[model samples]
Target: MINKLSIVKLNPIIIREDRKNYIVEDRKNGEFYEMPNPAVDAINLINKGKPLGDIEQILKVKYPNEDIDIIDFANQLLDLELISEVNGELILKEVDQFGPTGFLWIPESVSRFFFNKYSYIFYISLLLFNIYILLTNHHLLPNYKDYFIFSWMSLNILLWLGIGGALLILHEFGHIIAMRANGLPTRLSIGHRLFFIALETDMAAAWKLPSGKRNVLYLGGLCFDMVAFACALSIQYFYPTGPALLLAIMKILVIDIFIRFIFQCGVYMKTDLYFVIENISGSYNLMENAHHYIKSKFKKEARKAGEAVYEEEKRTIKSYSVIYFIGVLLTILVFVFYSIPQIITTMSHSIDRLSSPLFSKPFFDGAIVLVQTLTGLSLLLYSWYKKYRLKKE
Candidate 1:
């Protein structure tokens, strides 16, 4: 129970997330806890040496009978480790202010070239030309599976993985560059979203930027991906298949990158497009509200949650709930009917290749098979872990 006399201060580690919300980062455990806007404002006042009574009085004047309990809010912040008590008073911890900007830091100097608006226009124009050439030359286009030249061998898969990994790095750079273009500093790190390992750009700071710019920043990754796919397509138009292996590589790059591009449309998966819609609609809590609204249709327990949502947000959430439901249903159908079966088949085929008599004789080839098998297995396990065990960290 934080009382009026108890002096409290905001933990410096608790970052102001977006334009309207806050999130506390646990440096020790790599966790993020989102905070409500009101409590965050009170913490800001508290950090300025205001007593709890003063904070309560100020909030009372500001909100005017919103029934805000500063004491309870401050207690919650304490429980969340967003503020710490030191000798009857909360104190802020001093840490390196600009240290550890996520797993991969993008310094301004190297990334400056990417932030240029003129360069974006050039890149887009080139991509459009590439796409035009690709669409018209349908006869030269290879089948998607034609890229699997060695029947899922380790070396071939590794080549594809290397290309995909490089593209992912550029994809993240696109986000950083876009943020920098808007005169915003960005931090990025490697993190997980369910079963997927993802690059997290700390766009929480972008909340202060115009919503239009923020939306473009959210799309930066896709922008890079499109450029990559275009480059691969361009190569296809020039080489056409004279080099044999070049065609396979280009086809692989084109196909894989395009698939990843489509992955952005996965609203149920909270992909980039989801954030775009959320930001564009000004519904910061769209996902949470949408989940409740969708659930309330059939689940009695969710009715209160649906009711608790703000009226303005409810319209956006309700509309989004329908889209969310459709997206989820389609994902389930695709995974259950095609994706799971294809994976199982690939694993079986890989096992057969590894168990062959020739595999035992040539150590290198066998090693490749082993790597491919382990990679597949690791992804499966990661997916399960993400769905069942992973949370916020």
Candidate 2:
């Protein structure tokens, strides 16, 4: 177990330097560790094929006043499974690769077309066109009634789920494709953001990219959402009296896109917009820091909390606290004004339909509603458990 002569072989590591610390990333698993100068120097020596003894001597000579522990640092790396081998023996651990699983067939050149400077211009143009259409054709703006396209509640729910699910996939695909274009790995997963279930792209590896490049990746999903909304609006604008079924579906798409946009605006939850803001501001752990800052205000620990964050990030986090509260207020407003009313109306209608004759259409619709409600509650509870209790245990 002694390590004076131990030669450590490391797995692929990518180091990114921010204002405060060196973010040492285990590329194989997308794990990151914040390390100080000494630790980073030790890592550099290890990469240069220097034995542990040499590393210790080098670090000790370099930082004469500081107490440096190369062996302990190597052990920490070992625990993280970043060590690939020791003196010719394999030490790397088996773990799931969190890289791109789909769309590998698409070349980087092709995917890059979507995020190039010109594409952003197109995205903005389309967004403006959609706004113009909405302003000119006020009737096309989504109303709450647009959500109830079908007479049967269950049918409407099924239709929306089908279309919304597709849109969600496209939204996530935008992120995935953009990531691949940047020669990075990411995958889509489901997670809860407060009361909502969202499809998210795991872009932990994105830290390797420059902050400017990462903004494109972060905004990828929203860009696709805007494109979809614009396309649907354009079609409806040109053919106002199109086939009834097609027009009805377009109306549902508009409502789905509109709600999703509003949902992303509530950045208190980890939305795509939140990542963009965090990336552009160069603020690490903005969400957690902003949260701490807000709590500290009431407890009079604002100074302490402020000190805990990086010096460069202090001002940004303080400002972000304001945005965080605004986002929370937006969520509260949506919950009170839209969600509560929708829930009450749906439940009341379902209960009334449940009283209808057995095996009738109304009774079936009511049964479907009950099942849907129970399923949604189950998913929400499961998400909460997975996020909190399961992780601790």
Best by TM-score: 2
Clashing pairs in 1: none
Which of the numbered candidates is closest to the native, going by highest lDDT? 2
Q: Write the per-residue lDDT of candidate 2 for residues 57-132, one digit (tens) a residue.
A: 9989999988888888889888888898898898647786644455567789988889888999998998888889
lDDT (10s digit) by residue, model 1, range 122-240? 76786687667767887545444544677545666577667767877888878877776666666866555444456668776565455566777887877777777777787777766
The clash tally of candidate 1 reads: 0
Query: What C-alpha lDDT do the candidate models reach, one value each?
Result: 0.67, 0.81
User: Candidate 1: lDDT over CA atoms?
Assistant: 0.67
RMSD of 1: 4.9
Stretches > 4 Å off in candidate 1: 11-50, 80-110, 123-143, 176-212, 329-367, 379-393
Candidate 2 colliding pairs: none
- Model 2 regions more than 4 Å off: 1-9, 16-23, 27-30, 34-38, 49-75, 84-100, 135-137, 300-305
Worst 10-residue stretch by lDDT in candidate 1? 95-104
TM-score of each: 0.75, 0.85
The residue-level lDDT of candidate 1 at 391 comes to 60
